[model samples]
Target: MTGERGSEQGSPVRNGAGPGQEGRQPPVIAIVGPTGSGKSDLAVRMALELDGEIINADSMQFYRGMDIGTAKITAEERKGVPHHLLDTLDVTDEASVSDFQRESRAAIADIHRRGRRAILAGGSGLYIRAALDVLEFPGTEPAIRQRLEHDLEVSGLAPLRTRLELVDPVSAARLGDARRVVRALEVHELTGRPFSSFMPVREYFQPAVQIGLEVDRELLRERLAARVHRMVSSGLLDEVRRLDSLGLRRGRTASRALGYAQFLRVLDGEADEEQAAEETIVATRQFARRQLTWFRADPRIHWLDWQDPDLVAKALTLCG
Candidate 1:
């Protein structure tokens, strides 16, 4: 139980505010949405209005040199609000959900201690859940993990996927990557339980409100495509090159990021910038669709139209 914020560890409010002050504490506010859906801007606006700080839940934004492709908020865009957890990891480091859970919970507790709202913002579904939900992470056994990874490298994903399907059909249906397939098999072998058994239920770890940004599917596709093009025009390739030189390619998670992955091909002379941009656009749109599906499944989220003129006010109402 690596990600478990156990009862013995105490609640976020317990360390920050006493029982008498609990009634006065503001609920943790989370702004969640797909890429290019204005989550960061809305988070900033809400922070300004609510006297709050932002804790980034975007896994990509954790990397120090991954700004352009991840659309990390500019210093000016943060508007002097103290943002937590951005640029905390090197591009060569793999982002871990359990580690994020511990760090983000600590940040949230600190924000509450200062009596300011903690606004969790980003599009990463699992990272967001790890921050706000009663989630538990299974401990990793390196030997088993390495063996499964070696199997994946030698036998490929199909054989491993089939093995997972036999033991855990739910996770087999849900997971779509070789890395995750390996992780699922590793978990099962270590614990003798299906990996899906560890999935977080829709239970909040603390008083929290989730505001989801809803956008028209076609409009979001157009926005994502245009955003990728803008990233290209705004030196995304140069940023990728800089990070690549810093061993970005060696990082398991950072190297596979949307624009970074496609752009790496361009650097290798396999594809030109235009082809990379188009491919990135396609991949980004597909990612957005998956994000929408994940966020939509949570009944607790209050959905707001991304273009609503009174969006901030509506979100504030939900927070209250």
Candidate 2:
């Protein structure tokens, strides 16, 4: 999200979409939005209508056995439309946007090869960009990475975070996780440039169409709270408990997930489940805000009202 770039002049799609446009130069359709904004449902509808297969851009949904917490779409919910990149990683595996870019593009290529429209869907802005934009990841040096990792362990993130703020404040603000923070710091150390400076200039690596979903902020907050409550009632705690035995706590990214992290405190006797659920709701809401902020910066995305009655029909028209 931090490194992603786009125009600020993005306007909503009108009835003047390419209705007769098909197969001339096939476009990769990207569905993006804030969490709990129904991006997945909309994507499924689009995929169904367009004879498309989906390539996931949601980073959390990549992990296996992370269904409930991440709100991963169930197989039945997939409606027999083929989906790529879900449950492809173990909870213990670390995921980088670079790796995601590589894998997702491959999936997209395969979907195209099969003569199906490739629908990219998720709220992870950078992952989506990595898959579709001309973004380049900074090369890594093992020794530098090792040193940063050592520093992180010995002194904790505060000092390293301070350094990142001084050297690459943009990356520093966008990255809350220690792993990403350390990587950003390493990039600065290795390249003598701010991590953000390597961001993609507003250009796509592949021709693509981006559709954005926007929700009223107040309504979204209420919806997010209710969704988190539903997650708890639907066995998010039990899911975490099962994952913890599989070394989920050791998983850098998985351990830091909104619900999983808060519930970890509950499991440790530091909080109650209700309190944990409340914390999860608050954290998820904050995450949704960040997501909105990230997508809002990109003006190329055709914005659509999330609750529009003709949302699917309008989206298909845009694709057409």
lDDT of 1 by residue, 1-320 (tens): 12222111212221223455546657789999888899999999999998999999998898888989998999999999999999887777777777787789889989998989899999999888888787777767778878888888888999999999999999999999887888888778877989898887788777789999999889888888898999999999999999999999988778999999999999999999999999999999999989999999999998999999999999988988
Q: What's the TM-score of each model vs. the native?
A: 0.89, 0.85
For each predicted model, how many residue pairs clash, with residues at least 3 apart or on different chains? 0, 2
Instruction: Return the TM-score for candidate 2, rounded to 2 decimals.
Output: 0.85
RMSD of 2: 7.1
Tens digit of per-residue lDDT, candidate 2, span 1-320: 11111111111111111443333447899999999999999999889988999998898898899999999999989999899888887778776676677678778777877889999999988888877777676777779889999999999999999999999989888879887788788778887988777776667766789999989999999998998899999999899999999989988778898899999998899999999989998999999999989988988899999999999998888887
